[model samples]
Target: MLSKFYGEIFAILTSVCWAISALSFEIAGKKIGSLPMNLIRMSLALIFISIFSVFYNGNIIPQGANSEQLLYLVASGLVGFVIGDMLLFHSFVLIGARLGTLMMTMVAPISAIISWFALKEKMSLWQIFAMLVTIAGIFIVIYSRNKNHKKIEAKTKKASILFLGFLLAFGGAIGQAGGLVLSKKGVLNYDAFSASHIRIITGFLGYILIISFTRLWKKVFAGLKNTSALKTVSFGSFLGPFLGMSFSLIAVKNTSTGIAATLTSLAPVIIIIPAIFINKEKVSFLEILGAFIAVIGVALFFI
Candidate 1:
């Protein structure tokens, strides 16, 4: 009986896992920079996910997967990991994870729209209205009142960088949505963990191509020496690709894409407490209200 809601359960767990990883990656990205951090994180994640794969599936490589699954999973990896994560990590560095993840709330709507086109999934009027509420919450959080009642100076370089982060966050959302849609098509009857491994491999290869082309191979070695950063990366690797992403695939496989995406997109709200207390970032009451509104929107999807 409890097994029936596996999709929703895993999706919620994915949000928690992602919140932890986002904070960890934010720290590591700030320390080593996003480019180097990207290479190292994916590399480490591949190692971890591969280890899990070997024990879980009795093989280290994707075996018995047809060309279609392989192709789409590989594409998902390249777009989601290499491109989307680069943009996301940059946003984490530029605007901090709190704002970056908040901006990424669009992943729900993006996923819904893409699933509509690709999988012929349809949304009800109430769901569409809920999506709008989610967007409104994000807008409120992004444009929240400044700390101590201060106003943001629009004509400033800092403001410009924040705007760039916003754009990067949105791009990340689109990339992730595209990847999820592709993975849904690819993971038919495949083990969720196995699918995640293939996706990582594709991202790993994509990163290798980028670094080789750009002559950034040396930077990866340099990044490995950041012991402090590597520690965080290791933790993030386990929480993210190993558990977070695999379960996301499970959610996608077991439930409607829109429902899974909406549940997993709760990271922004989950990160708020850690950001405010642990990270000591200032958050306004308006932001809290906005988060509640977004949660309401997500909850509305069940109806």
Candidate 2:
């Protein structure tokens, strides 16, 4: 019973970690291209997850992972880590951090709906309504800043950038949704921690492939001396692939994909706490209201 409760807690923790990672990586990606940052962060994540899984589970590779499971995990790692993060980081470059994260809220519903069809997971009417409300909240947040003429004028010339950012974010949403379903399939027979290690291994390989095609390996080596940036990437890696992903797989194992994803979307709100206090960003009533609505939508998943 305690284990089950902790599982749920870990699921929520996954969201918090994701939020922190997104914010931190956004800052790092601004200095370095998303591809280079991805290579660094994923490398750190692979090493950290390997160490943690070995210490906790006494095994490195996922036990009983068959060919099909391996395929699914590899696919998941490629799409989620490679395509998904690549696009997401690009979106951060195209748009500002807040808007990029807001757009990414689509990941939960997209993944949830896809998981339902692909995995034949069930959802209650209330859950569907909750999803609708969550999307509504996201839209409100996006448009909420529109009412400010000054803000609009400031970002007006960059409309094209915002459009591309939206596209990248949408692509990432699809990748994350698909990745979750695939990971669910791949981890069906293994411990969550071990499954995480497998995913990280594939993710590491995917980044390596990116380096092969783009020759970004040299760039990554050059930027390694930026201690502050490297530290930020390391922090993001620790929160993201190491802890966030491990808990996410555990969440999907214990809960429905839709529920787990919706719950995870709470990251945006968690981000606000840091943004307001740490970043010293101003908060508006509408943003606060939108956050409240999103939280309510997340809560509806349990009902």
Best by TM-score: 2
Kindly report the root-mean-square deviation of model 2 from the true structure over all alpha carbons: 2.9
lDDT of 1 by residue, 1-303 (tens): 547778878888998999899789879877877777777777888898878778887887768789988998988887888788778867876766656666676787789889999999886788678667766765566547333222333333377887898899889989988899889988888888889989988887887887788787677787788899999988998898778999999999987687778778777677787988888988878889978887787666555
Candidate 2 residue-wise lDDT, 1-303, digit = tens: 546445456668998999899888878877776788888888899889777767876766556678888888888888887788778766766765456666666777887778878899887888778877866665565556545742764556476766788788888888888888888888787678777888888888888897789888777886587788899999999999889999998998887787677766667667778989999988788878888887777666554
lDDT of 2 at 19: 86
Model 2: per-residue Cα lDDT at residue 119: 93
TM-score of each: 0.85, 0.87
Report the Cα lDDT for candidate 2: 0.78
The count of residue-pair clashes in candidate 2 stands at 0
RMSD of each: 3.2, 2.9
Query: Which 10 successive residues of model 2 have the least lDDT summed?
Result: 145-154
